[model samples]
Target: MFAAFDRPRISLRDAMAEALTKVPDVEIDPEGTFKYILVRVKDGDKQKDIVRGTKAAEYHNHIFDKVKPALEALGMECECLGGGKIEHNGKEKKIRVFGESTAFGKAEHSVSVEKLKTVFSNYEITWSDDKK
Candidate 1:
C-alpha cells in the first residue's frame, strides 16, 4: 500500500501545459500571484476629480475668490466654470478659466484677453474664439 502512494508525480512541463488549457478566474502574474486585489475606486463620475488636481484646484479657488471679483469690478461679467490643463512654455500647466460669457463684446474681449495675459504671463492662454 505504501508503494502505491509513492507513484511518480506529473512533470512540471506537463502540469504547466494542463493549467494553460483552462482559463483562470483571476489573472496570474509571472510570479504565480494574483495581478490585482481589492479594487476600491469606482469608475463613475471622474470629471470633477480630473478637473480638481492639486494645481488646478488652487487656481480655481483663486479665480473664484480674486480674479472674478476683479474682472466684475472692471464692468466685465466673469464666470468661473472650473479648471483644466494646458501646455504652456512646453510644459503642462493647470488653468483656472474654463468658462463662457455673452458679456464680452469685441472691445471687452480684447481687453479681457490682455488682462488675462498680464495676470497669467507665464501661461499660454487659448481663448474660446481661438485667439491666443
Candidate 2:
C-alpha cells in the first residue's frame, strides 16, 4: 500500500528527453541524436503577396535599401548572389532577392515542407525533397 503511493522516479536522461520538447528548431535523427541545431526565418505566402506587385517592389526596396547603411555601420562583409525583377504583363513588378553572407549562410537552405506549412499556418504550402 505504501509503495503504491510512492511517486514515480524519472532518470535525468528521461527528464532531458521530455524537456527537449520546449526547445524549437531541434532535430533528432533516425538514431535519435543531434550534434547541432540551426534556426532561420523564411518567406511565406504572405511574403509572396507582399513581393508580387509594384507596390511590393517599392516596399521591399525600402526595407533593403536600409541594409547597406546598416552593414556599413556594422562593418560586415556581404555580397549579392544574383536576383532580378519579375514581370507578369510586361511591366516591372516584384523583386527576387538572393545573397551570400558570411554572417549567416546555410548549405541546405531548406525547410521541411511540413514544417513550412506549420510555420505559415497555411496547409496549402507544399513541397517534396525526394528524388525518384
Candidate 3:
C-alpha cells in the first residue's frame, strides 16, 4: 500500500489560485492566470499590467519570486514591475504589477505551455494571442 507521503503534491497553479482569493480586485481565473503568464513568456517584450492596488502589487511581488525560477528554467526572464503608472482613458492609473518576459521564443513558448499543462492539468488551455 502507498504511504501518505506518496500522495500527489498540490500544483503551483492550484496554490496560486487559492492565494489569489485573498488579493484585492482580482477575479480568480485559475486558467487565465496560467495563460497570462504563458503569453508574457511568449511575447518576451510586451508589458502587460496584471493587477491594480497596493495589496495586489504586494501579492504579485511576493509570488513572482516563487515563479521566477520556473520561467528561467524555460529560458525566460521575468520581473515584477512595481510602482508604475499608465494613462488609461485620459486618467492616470496606478499599475500594481507589470508582466514582462525576456529571452523566450517559439520553442520556449511551446515548452512553457506544456509545462503549464502538466502543472495545471485540470484546465484545458487554449492558445490565443489576444490578451483578454
Name the best candidate (by TM-score): 2
lDDT of each candidate versus the true structure: 0.31, 0.28, 0.34
Best by lDDT: 3
lDDT of 1 at 37: 15
Clashing pairs in 3: none
Per-residue lDDT value at 89 in model 1: 33
How much does candidate 1 score in TM-score?
0.24
Clashing residue pairs, backbone N/CA/C < 3 A, model 1: none
Winner on lDDT (1 vs 2): 1
Off by over 4 Å in 1: 1-59, 90-132
lDDT of 1 by residue, 90-113 (tens): 244322222322222112223333
What lDDT does candidate 3 reach at residue 23?
A: 28
Cα lDDT of model 3 overall?
0.34
Question: TM-score for each prediction?
Answer: 0.24, 0.31, 0.25
lDDT of 2: 0.28
